[model samples]
Target: MKTYNVAILGATGAVGQEMMNVLAERDFPLNKLRLLASKRSVGKTYQYKDQVIACEEATPDSFEGMDIVLGAVENDIAEQLLPHAVKAGAVVIDNSSAYRLDDNVPLVVPEVNPQDIQKNNGIIANPNCSTIIALVAINKLHEYATVNSIIASTYQAVSGAGVPGLNELNTQVTQVMNDEKVEPQVFPYQIAFNLIPQIGGFDEMGYSSEEMKMQNEGRKILHHPELNVTCTCVRVPVMRSHSESLTLFFDKEIDVEKAKELLANADGVKLVDDPNNKQYPMPLDTSDQDLVYVGRIRKDLTQNNNKSLTLWCCGDQVRKGAATNAVQIAIEYIKQNA
Candidate 1:
């Protein structure tokens, strides 16, 4: 058995807390564990099996002798800590979007591209929540039939924005129920019982940052630069789990049954397609689930050339998308380095 020292950056945030839960649940080997957060959360105690560890302010020296640093902070914080971790001879598995597109950094999903981790320049990136769930279900299909294009629309949860986003949604819902006017804070538009078509800031091309991530990150993970993706990411009024409606266009003709068969046996994906009585993947069913739930597989009616297939997928974004993937990277690093 190999043991390694681990540190969780942004230890008081939502993704950081989720990383702690995943580390405990997966029983990861830990010779030493450290929690680093902002000044506001410093000195806060987080317990695991009676071992109460105090959260410290994350600085350049936070990575001292650390074997692996699980980054659960924003892109700026990740950008700052990544080099520090590398300087300390610790590999950084970041959950932020900072390094996802860096030519030197490897954007990895253990199920889709475990080999990508081997290309890491001391930094591995966990992809966007919607992209991770979508790719986990479709990468197997892509393996058999190459993907030429993807049209995805995401129904993401409030939790994707973190705990404060959830609180803002819940507060607005309460205000509306009480016949009072609701005010939006964390989101650009109202998010209670409403859908905000924007997940991240808009780019010059009119696509939101969250929407473009699917295309940019997909190419890196699949090693397919010409893979075109058109996505519209929406923030829904849900607590957890992100759902996506995907219509994938393959280079070769693909049969729906064959695609289902391929996805049924794919890693990190759970096929739940049973449309006889309206059974398929849903945010409610997929919440807290580790596996990416995929269903609603069908041939695209508009594109009758047998090149396109539509599907629905759901998964716990914080787990499979952020924390679980980061922890898996840590495990892979241990396996290779130990």
Candidate 2:
């Protein structure tokens, strides 16, 4: 078996750490695993399998002799560092939105568009966490019947914002329980016992940056440029998974039973649609795993035709959405080009 040298940028952060876990869990073929982060985090130790690897400060020279570099940093840092990794002869699978829409880079969701991986020009961008969970749940349906449009409402977890978001939610909930004043820092307002309708800065048309990602990234991943999406993203107090209510309009007739049949055999999806018994997808059941749980499948009540269907889905944003997706891209890359 051939093994490759891999490096993880932003190794101390939530997604970065999860990338390591996924790499270990999947038992990726590796000759060496390097953990790279800021100077402040240098010497931080992480366990991969039975080996304890210490974090090293990421520099231009960090990608020396590396075959793959998984990026889990913010856009600015990704913009600054990832290109250098590419220059050093490493193919980068980036989780940041920095290069997602770039014409030269491929935005990939492995199950939805693994073919696009071969088209990458040294970089592949992972779709937004919410975009990933939604698309994974719907890709099979789209393939069976061409999806013309999507109306989605996302209930995002605070963990989507990273470790700070998680910490802020924890602190605020505690403060509220103790009858203390809540101070909002990571979020615009208190996220404990509240829902914030805004996930990113609003556009002139009133759609937020996060809401627009569903349309833009979805189009790129599904290769359906004409696909329309109207999305509303909300930040909820859930600790891990993100849940979404999706109403899909297809080009051809697709009944509820057919949608359920397609999703039952779909990759990366678990069907839990026994609504009569009060079974449906929820954040608590879907958290801490890679599969996207989909349920509540039914016909759209407002739409008269069979072309419209409504369903709900939940997935762990931190795992399948960010870390596992990037790792999957790397795995696919190795399988194709190894």
- TM-score: which candidate is best? 2
The local lDDT score (0 to 100) that residue 39 gets in candidate 2 is: 98
Expressed as tens digits, the lDDT of each residue in 1-338 for candidate 2 is: 99999999999998999999899899999999999999999998989999999999999889999999999999999999999999999999999999999988999988999999999989999999999999999999999999889999999999988999999999999999999999899999999999999998999999999999999999999989998999999999999899999999999999988999999999999999998899999999988889999999989999787899999999999999999999999999999896
User: What tens-digit string does per-residue lDDT give for candidate 1 at 262-307?
Assistant: 9999999989999898889988887775899999999999886898
Q: What is the TM-score of candidate 1?
A: 0.97
Q: Which candidate achieves the best lDDT against the true structure?
A: 2
Compute the lDDT of residue 26 as modeled in candidate 1.
87
Among all windows of ten consecutive residues in candidate 1, which has the lowest summed lDDT?
A: 329-338
lDDT of 1 at 4: 84
lDDT score at residue 338, model 1, on the 0-100 scale: 64
How well does candidate 2 score on lDDT at residue 239? Answer: 93
- Model 2 CA deviation exceeding 4 Å by range: none
In model 1, pairs of residues that clash are: none
